[model samples]
Target: MNPFLPMTRQDMENRGWDELDFIFVSGDAYVDHPSFGPAIICRLLEKHGYKVGIIAQPDWRGEEDFRRLGRPRLAFLVSSGNMDSLLNKFTAAKKTRHEDAYSPGGKSGCRPERAVIVYTNKLREIWPGVPVIIGGIEASLRRFAHYDYWTNRVRRSVLMDSQADLLVYGMGEKQILEIASDLHQGVAVENIQDVAGTCYRVPDFDYVYDYVKLPDFETVAVDKKAFADAFADIYLEQDAIRGKKLVQRNGEACVVQNPPAMPLTEEEMDEIYDLPYQRTYHPMYEKAGGVPAIKEVKFSLVSQRGCFGGCNFCAIVSHQGRIIQRRSHASILREAKLLTELPDFKGYIHDVGGPTANFRRPSCDEQLQRGTCRGKECLSPTPCKNIVADHSDYLSLLRELRKLPKVKKVFIRSGIRFDYLMLVKDSFLEELCKYHISGQLKIAPEHISDRVTRLMGKSNKEVYRKFVQRFKAMNERLGKKQYLVPYFMSSHPGARLEDAIELAEFIRDLGYRPEQVQDFIPTPGTLSTAMYYSGIHPLTGEAVYTAKNPQEKRMQRALMQYWIPGNRPLVREALRLAHRTDLIGFDKKCLVHPEKTAGQEKNKPRKRR
Candidate 1:
């Protein structure tokens, strides 16, 4: 059996290793699956001839759990699991979430808030000079000075706050190996500043060269325009091919972020996924019922990585970069066949996609050579003219997967870029509706208002409407009764009360009741989050309306699910606030009925008493 990485001293001794080259510390329970970031990083290190161990969800209050594996010879790789800790532990309302999918038995509070910073601080206190390199979603997104939604303030770069020697951003395999090789050659961590896709702090300007200087942390913390400007500079230079080095000062220290690592080739992506992952949570957590997050990805195959559908609210572009990196179909098929051998697969492949399911290649051929266009999106406002928007490769891949023996059904559960879908003049949709979708195909239009959609970097309402009509027509032609489950967000920056009301009206007209609506959470390092914090669009330098007040946010959210009886009062209040009381009436178009007075109730005709 392929065993998990050593997690305890005995496991290390069982492997007959005297010393480990690296000890990975993560805020999530040890799930030795490719879907888990820590697992991938550790497995990749192991593949590269390094003896690595893991310390998963160690107690932050003391050093006892931190010392389980002892110090590594090279460095301690740290991460806040797959998600940012605050996002995992708190709802969009900032209320404490009771369940953490990444934790054992789905328990919350397994890790502290600001886990990257907390874990790094603890490690620093215990092992003074050992290198602590922070990455994963928490460190990657927070590598720069950013708006902290929990604190409602601008915070310094995670490198400075966590006091980590180096911070790896984006997908970390390339950077981690480079850092490891340098350290193995006896290069000091402090001197390892030139690695791409990493951020390192320097005492002064002496270490900075050929870099774009963002507005200092102090200036951005106080000045909204400065904050917007700084974020714009940061956002524009995220491309690995043409991106420049970035520097920002936090008090006396300067944080320098090198250009992103080059996109992984097909062979590289294949190699990473082909690592001998045990493909399950560690046995130690079986008593606690294992990690809940594994259930979603255990039988699923990740067909691709990185998304080009640059939704402002999504951080995929920031974390995974825009250039599409996908595994060859043979590799994905190999994984699919592996899933068939699993005891619990049930002949069903849960999903076969990534951030944007349909994106199997770069948005356009030019992006590969010149990087993503500066200040221009491939499929937003409208699909770029140069975008290939081909689905042949993806469709072929899906067809091959469906033919694999013992695979009864293959599904595409990940988000499909509908706008990109619309661009493809092929049988992709027909195959999708007939084979992949299970009665209902979910799509994210986000909002119906063109104004909001523009700000969201999503295709307009008309695009979604056209796609809906096509989907319905296709389902009808196939004599199938399929429905569209559209997702909409509430209270996003640039979305006013009226916009929310308008969305409710659209839902009312469509005769669709949304069971679940997403409320915008302004997490760090996205354009939407920057707009939410600064009240200005970072890229456009224009004022954007954000519903920051809890009451107003509630009202906006209530408008989306106006059909819910419990949300009626807030819906009514939102209608009144938006001066859209016209929607509160007896008409079919009205979202809610007017409140009946006591006198009116008394005057109501009784049935023949």
Candidate 2:
């Protein structure tokens, strides 16, 4: 149940309900990714026969309204994102503040205020006896002290501040369902310790069976100072098999290094997508609506899961595992056909892609046979532990999607790994340029400097440029207007002012201007954040370059956007402050005299006839 939904708890009580079963809340817009977070838990509980509801974009006020819905014996689950927010402070569970009441489709560019943090604590204040579960991207990723990208160091764990009964990590569908099944049958939620991926506080410490363990989350009250101190040295290990200290209590913690939650098996994904949105298997989405009208819409679909492109700043591979799982071509076509029959089917399929869009099977099938991979984090220096990097089947799937008569156009909107795409055959590239040209293709080259790019585990920026050139040339020779749109990041650890300047110079040379610059937000459990916090490479555990604030990051970002003639003075000033004016323009000669640059000219340089 989305927590933001209006409630009529008293009406439900009058309808003869002794006690409510379960409730769910999320910060996500709640678009229904059924397999993730509350969506999964709700579906599983329904199968086991329990009344449930979700609250999306929750409102913390009117605590009485929530209690009036059912008796004291109830269970609640809360989530903020696809991953955990960086607010794990164990001794103190609830943040003593509330966020402004900005609804969904609102609140775009702003840091959450102290008020937003206190909004969730209202549940505990109102109904002290009910069981509350907080899991999801924000909770899971920040289950322990982790590097805070914005502030650039390990911060407190989230479990302490939110004070939920349980904080689950990984895919919690199965875990949460079993916990609820036992609870509805009258088992006390506190006694449910066998549940995997669950974090809670206990009365005393015990020897951890494996890497780490946690006390019941409820037992821990808010201790902001202790929580902050605990994470003072916390950071991520990019090459970690279990993802660095899977559990932490004060200074003590466990390292159950794991990757992305299990990906959808090809068969399972196929079955999910084929569900003619018109007639879903269960009443979950398709309640008896106004009519059996032709509800046809072209939907973008995920073709594979997990990524092995060990980019230090990312956590996708950590959460989803490096191995890619692909849905079958036939399965995709089946869904495409269903879309065509829809009343609104516009004969255009948005796209069929996932993580990298091109990678098909898990990276390494051979490694899978050898049992679990030792190299868990996909963002690593070594070749992916799962070596089965095959994309042919995926290419085939795209060809078939193009053939569907009802499908007028297919845009590869989900991102593509240009390096991997470059590996694709020339004919495939030509066809891709010819058929799949929805004007532009999106890719993440990250940065241009080789050292910085290598640190992020991304391909050389040169490769991306070449890829763009190939794409442009292929389309142009065919008289088609196609373009390459690359995504780049600034101020990743190891990216110093020199590197930023080089990237800016490269972009200037390419004659291609970026529409948007991605300012990195260090999510709770990412290696990049870890590297940023400790100034250490996550894999090698070696110290590396790092930046400490938004100002430094912003300057690096500005360098890319204002690389033309007019901003040379600004770049000079930034470089002087950065102590990186050893190169041209910043040399004493350029600094002493003001010379107008192409950036100042505005229009492209006039070609000297």
User: Top model by lDDT, which number?
Assistant: 1
Error of 2 at 71 (Å): 4.6
| Deviation (Å) of 248 in candidate 1 | 0.5
Supply candidate 2's per-residue lDDT for 456: 83
The lDDT, on a scale of 0 to 1, for candidate 1 is: 0.92
Q: Candidate 2 regions off by >4 Å?
A: 1-20, 29-41, 71-74, 82-120, 149-154, 204-207, 212-246, 251-264, 267-298, 328-331, 341-344, 371-386, 424-427, 549-551, 563-568, 575-609
lDDT of 1 by residue, 264-298 (tens): 99999999999988899999999999989999999
Model 2 clash tally?
A: 75
